[model samples]
Target chain A: MWVIKRSGEREEYDENKVKQALLRSGASEAEADEILEKLRGRVYNGITTHEIYQHVRRMLDRKRKIRYSLKDAIFSLGPEGHFFESLVARLFQETGYAVRVRECIRGRCIPHEIDILAERGSERYLVECKFHNSAGTRCGIQTALYTYARFLDISEVMPFASPWLVTNTKFSGDVITYARCIGMRLLGWRFPEDGGLESLLESHKLYPITILAIKKDVRNSLLTNGIITIKEIFTKKDRIYDILPELKANEVLYAARAVAECL
Target chain B: MWVIKRSGEREEYDENKVKQALLRSGASEAEADEILEKLRGRVYNGITTHEIYQHVRRMLDRKRKIRYSLKDAIFSLGPEGHFFESLVARLFQETGYAVRVRECIRGRCIPHEIDILAERGSERYLVECKFHNSAGTRCGIQTALYTYARFLDISEVMPFASPWLVTNTKFSGDVITYARCIGMRLLGWRFPEDGGLESLLESHKLYPITILAIKKDVRNSLLTNGIITIKEIFTKKDRIYDILPELKANEVLYAARAVAECL
Candidate 1:
């Protein structure tokens, strides 16, 4: 079967590709085989990868295995910039810190708009979020160095505050080393092995709304309006309905509850 | 007499320096001599270069020679970013073009916020404003190249619109050559020699309020509220008064009139 990719390129579909993906997501050998067998029955001559992804997501959602496919949902949160900042801020807030997003703070040399500022008790964190919509991109040394320089300027005034750099994607080895050397906390999608962005989100039961199986434009509209987390969608359901009035009330509520169940 | 420099180094006050600056401004040798003689009585030990600048500015303001000193006034308009974009937008408006500031246009690859979009008759221009707060900085080839890429992405959609790069400071020779080769119009502090940013502002009798000698915080507050041009200050005088309630009414009105006189 021919499968269309996101970039509009066509490629031959392989059952092994599906099996491997399921296996990586912690599916047992028998479970992976059963899903592939079911998927094979629905194969067509020209099916989009997005269609296949939705099919798999639905199957996983039914089996309570959506947690394994949450990464793909996060990737849907694009074209990236401020939306990612909001996601990071929401994540921090979920962990019991008061968060401020896109704050313009005066540094010693120049003024900078910090992505996230989180405070818990006397401890404050000035976060620099580097978000990459494409999984192929990685945060590098240049980003770490620049963040460190800004931190140096800001630390003069707020010495008690610490600098933390977070990315939706992973960081390069050089960036990790430099950040470690400077004592700057570095978080990525999956870098610290035991505790990265995914692990933290899983720990806090905080999943971004982008992972919901809704229309892309609806997800983008919600993100644009600073609605990212499942909790936000639940709490601000009326606002979400107001922004996307065309979307049915039950549909929005169902999607929110569906994603919240996975979290 | 001692004079301080921008770098904070102190040097003996030289009459020749004053004469050279005035001569560069198109003052005749005799006129330069007369200005220097008048300035001699005001010289003092440990006097700052900024103090000397005020004396020279007063002399120029009196003689309507403020054109020569307008660059310094432009530099005063920052902790830079969006304020400079507003200034450029205002400049385009003064030149009889309908302008849009911070417009997000959809490009082929991604969305881009064009700093200024100027439309006049059948002509449309996509402008990128590179603002540098420090005098020592210059817009380089990287900026030119990156801007060219965005222009290419945008021009596919806006085929009629040409790309123009404007900077508060000058451009390096390499950047000028690259831009010229690509047919991208370039504007900078002293670029194109005859009609740079300074000349453009002077020709149109447009000057930003940063040169108004008000407290930096007040000027910043005004710029933050989208008040950049002298006309904006005059028209939005109440907004300025509201932002700066601590300042007496006469103080704001007097500063507005003082800057207006130069224009």
Candidate 2:
């Protein structure tokens, strides 16, 4: 049989092979076989790798078989973070963008945090997440103010770029009006225009970050131990598979390159 | 020239003479004169003794002319503690009900906590104030629960009494409906039915409690000197009024009789 993946690639489907792969990924033997049986009609030759991974992930999550460590990595939103990153991760996934939450901005002796950084094709967005009842001067006017500040800090050595502020709280009425007046694209939580809080993630079409992307991203990023910023992933001009494995094989080379370029 | 007194009562007109009276009450000569100037036509001969005292209180508040001790006392919300007291105080005053921010609850060991309790024409209302966000249960329902609980407590002694709940945050839709279903009145920071906060006070024609009332009540209850709680006031009503100089000696005897019977 053959299956078409989310990425529109075709893949050969072999029940035993799929079951073995799921087992290797920590699913129990019976669990893996059960997944294969459930996914029987969905498998096909030339199916995208992403589709295969998705099948395995959904199977595990449905069975409540997720590992604690794996769950933490999936949900982590960096230090002292709020729930906005979770919302962004969910929404971006629905928008067909590959999203990662709390990817570290690594280069120098000190590390930085990005709330979320997502990419689709060559397009990438660096996002800072904020949640507030009413926006205040410091955190309100520019939700991404901190991102820009971080950018300035790393611009000297890293190829620093691509940032946006994604907030659960809307900008102040005056600030929103002013932003529009000044031609700044303000995307945030607001009613009617964006479906308010109740329908926020639903309207964005991202209910949750799919588990496959989460597993693969965590595996690759931890392999090199060199921090991956969403910026680097977007700027690579290639699929994460191509870039991630190479960094995994040669951590020293990747780290050197990352440090040499100002991000 | 006539002057309104501290009790909200009108008195004989004598601009300089009333100024001297304010000075005798510890106001600076200049401030006393200034208060008297503000008091000019507000007074009329044969004005009630209570009205004369109220004029002084208003002048002091408007001009910020009271001694720091008295100022602190007025702002403290004596027996009604917490944000609810402040909200009720503001609401009651805004509604034109001669609102006393904190009325000392006429008891021993009740402590000084102002939770806005409004009184008009022999009808006394106790209000519990709450300020909450969308995250918690609605203030309306919560307040209604408290009202029921308080009513249960008081009903054991005197049956069929209800208290009101005032909140700074607006109620949730379902919570509001539920509150209405359960026969609870919901008040927001502003409501047209209440004639808005300020107009509510205007219509009620109520004034703040006079210092004399506070002093009289405090001494009668002897709250500052150590008596506290309604129970104590009831039990010790026999000698309560004699200790309070501000009360007419006869009124004290009558109040003691009332307290004993209520108990």
Candidate 3:
């Protein structure tokens, strides 16, 4: 059977590809096989890969195996980069760094409102968060280049450990190649081959609050109130119902707990 | 009466603004007055400034008092920047600069695709063309910043007079301020309050053949055949028929001559 890709290109469906993805998202061999068997029985002649992905995610989610919704949850935080910046700040903070989000600093040439300013002991990091509302947009070489340039300007005034570029989307091939050649640190979706934002979130258990089934207004209020992570959801059990009012405190906590223990 | 601005803001209609724009587009004072008189009969409450602009353009086009369709013509040349790049190269060449369009050059850090590299006497210019397919999108500060950064990289390999940025749209306020501060030359629609792309084209009598009544395929073939400018149509009068045998040579020439003598 043929499968349509996100770009609307069609190719023959590959069961191995589906299994690999399921395994990557923390599913077991038995679970992957079971999901694929179910999928084989359901897929049509020209089913979209997105539909296949959603099917697997739903199956996994039903089995209490989280798909992370890592990319989607981050996207939910934005049509703007504001919440993503806060999330980035939290990630840095949780990783044992003192962090600041959206702080304007004097560079050698001009002032820059840095997305995340992170420091662990003697190592200071300058991070720029590039958030996209939709999927399939990659952070290009130009963004990486400008981030490096901005780092240069700021470094002249005050040195940094390295310039860190973070994003919700993937980075282009040139971005990956160029950043490696120059010493710019990059963190984004499934990049660097070994350690990307997915690994970062999974390794640290730093799931965003938006990963839970929070409504739009409630999510905004949560971000505004600085309940950025799942840990914060459990921590702020008293205040969440006050902001949401619609959600019972236990249901939200239970959901947050379920997401945290996805692995 | 209140008029709707491009940003959808309603403000009292100022006839002087329209008159001044008409005058700037080479309409005589009497002609501007005549156009305004005609506009008064048709405008409705909640009518967009775009509609007003279009109505005036129609009247001017009817009188053979050409509005240049300068922005629209440039937009027609693209869904890609290829034709726009060619147009830019021609503009530079017409102004006595020996230009190379889309050439790769060695920069300080990496390779750069210098869009229009122009050399005149001892002065060399690295021109970057930022072409937007649609209206109402301005080249932002980040673009300006990155362009400057790229220039700095290229300048380390070979010195140019300055990095020249050309666009078919306006620059954001910070871009304008920053570029002016850094002495980077900017040419785009209605910028610098003096000479812009509109002025450059007018001063040089250089008009892209897309401005004339050439159909899509014919225009593409014309561009491919190096019949970019209207003056080229006149000069290469023989070849114009060969490239577009569908169009009568005399009619095309007549239209070319009309657009050329718009001022």
**TM-score top scorer:** 3
Q: What are the per-residue Cα lDDT tens digits for candidate 1 across A50-82?
A: 788667766763424556656766776666677
Q: Is candidate 1 or candidate 2 better by lDDT?
A: 1
What is the model-wide C-alpha lDDT for candidate 3?
A: 0.80
Candidate 3 local lDDT, A104-210, one digit each (tens): 99876667889899999999999998987766688987898788878877888999989999988898877876687668898888876698887887777777888
Candidate 1 chain A weakest ten by summed lDDT: A61-70
Cα distance off (Å), candidate 3, residue A157: 3.2
TM-score of each: 0.47, 0.24, 0.91
Candidate with the larger TM-score of 1 and 2: 1
TM-score of 3: 0.91
Write down the lDDT of every candidate, Cα atoms only.
Answer: 0.75, 0.46, 0.80
Candidate 3 lDDT over B93-199, as tens digits, reads 88789999889997756787888999999999988888897667898767777788788878888999998888888988767766776778898997766888878
| Candidate 2 ranges beyond 4 A from true positions | A1-263, B1-75, B78-128, B131-165, B168-185, B188-263
Error of 1 at A76 (Å): 35
Q: What is the interface RMSD of each candidate, in Å?
A: 11.8, 22.3, 2.2
